[model samples]
Target: DTAVSQTPKYLVTQMGNDKSIKCEQNLGHDTMYWYKQDSKKFLKIMFSYNNKELIINETVPNRFSPKSPDKAHLNLHINSLELGDSAVYFCASSQVGLNTEAFFGQGTRLTVV
Candidate 1:
């Protein structure tokens, strides 16, 4: 029973392939998010869905799309993945307040060859 978890902690692939990263949270939080941690360790929020409704959307590539089936899970699906997408994809969650601390998963490192 983890608060937030992501699968395939490491990912390495070719430049033009399709891949997906899965995220899940069991903290009973209404808002869940996806973040991309670059080589510089900069954590940028990609998508945030609250109660199945999208709230925060960042400037990400069109090939990268986030799908949330429910409040407990959010998944990232990438099509025609590029080398630029080679970064650590993290799943995070936080309460609907800035004061709340955001929790993160171990992350999946997607490497495009």
Candidate 2:
């Protein structure tokens, strides 16, 4: 019984390809976010949305895009992917941002060959 689950725990693809990851949460949370964790395990917030409304986008490249069709679901779409984009993508959920604890999914490993 996973609370928040993301499709394709591992993804391998060639460079300059496009990929999409689907995410969903059953915790009834109102806010969700997408984070990137590099090889160094340094985590950073990329995009956040609440109730299908995008609320935060921080220093992320245009190739990465996030879409939330509903409060419990947010999907990631990448265009023209690159080798540098290889990393673990995490989907997280929170009641709210300020001083709130966000639950993270296992993560999807994207490898650009």
Candidate 3:
């Protein structure tokens, strides 16, 4: 089974629309995160949740929201999407406390026009 999985691997939408991407992990981890990869392939963490509580949040715009329903699930929602939001989104999970290797799901590429 995949350690992490995301739905709608590719998304194409018009500007000003709203969209959501779902993610799940089966690795029994306590921390889940949402990351965005820009065209230059720079990965930046947008939000992180540990044990269903927000632990880390970068300076992402209010348009981006991350929700974690459980320890193994994290979802991202974007409102009034802009062309600048076009990028690849990845979901990752890792155990909390000690340093552990993170597992990433196949990224979801979003294109806004």
Give the candidate number with the greatest lDDT: 2
Provide the TM-score for each candidate, comma-separated. 0.95, 0.96, 0.97
Report the poorest 10 consecutive residues by lDDT, candidate 3. 93-102
lDDT of 2 by residue, 1-113 (tens): 89999988999999999999999999999999999999999998999999999999998999998999899999999999999999999999989857898999999999999
**TM value for model 1:** 0.95
Error of 2 at 14 (Å): 0.5
After superposing candidate 2 on the true structure, give the runs of residues whose Cα lies further than 4 Å from its correct spot. Answer: 97-99
What is the RMSD of candidate 3? Answer: 0.8
* Candidate 3 residue-wise lDDT, 29-63, digit = tens: 98899999999999999998999999888999999
The candidate maximizing TM-score is: 3
Single out the weakest 10-residue window by summed lDDT for candidate 1. 93-102
Q: In every candidate, how many clashes are there?
A: 0, 0, 0
For candidate 2, the TM-score is 0.96
Q: Write the per-residue lDDT of candidate 1 for residues 1-113, one digit (tens) a residue.
A: 78899998998988889999999999988889898889999989898899988888898888988898999999999999888899998999888876888889999998999
Clashes of 2: 0
Off by over 4 Å in 1: none
Predicted structure 3: lDDT: 0.93
Q: What is the lDDT of residue 99 in candidate 1?
A: 88
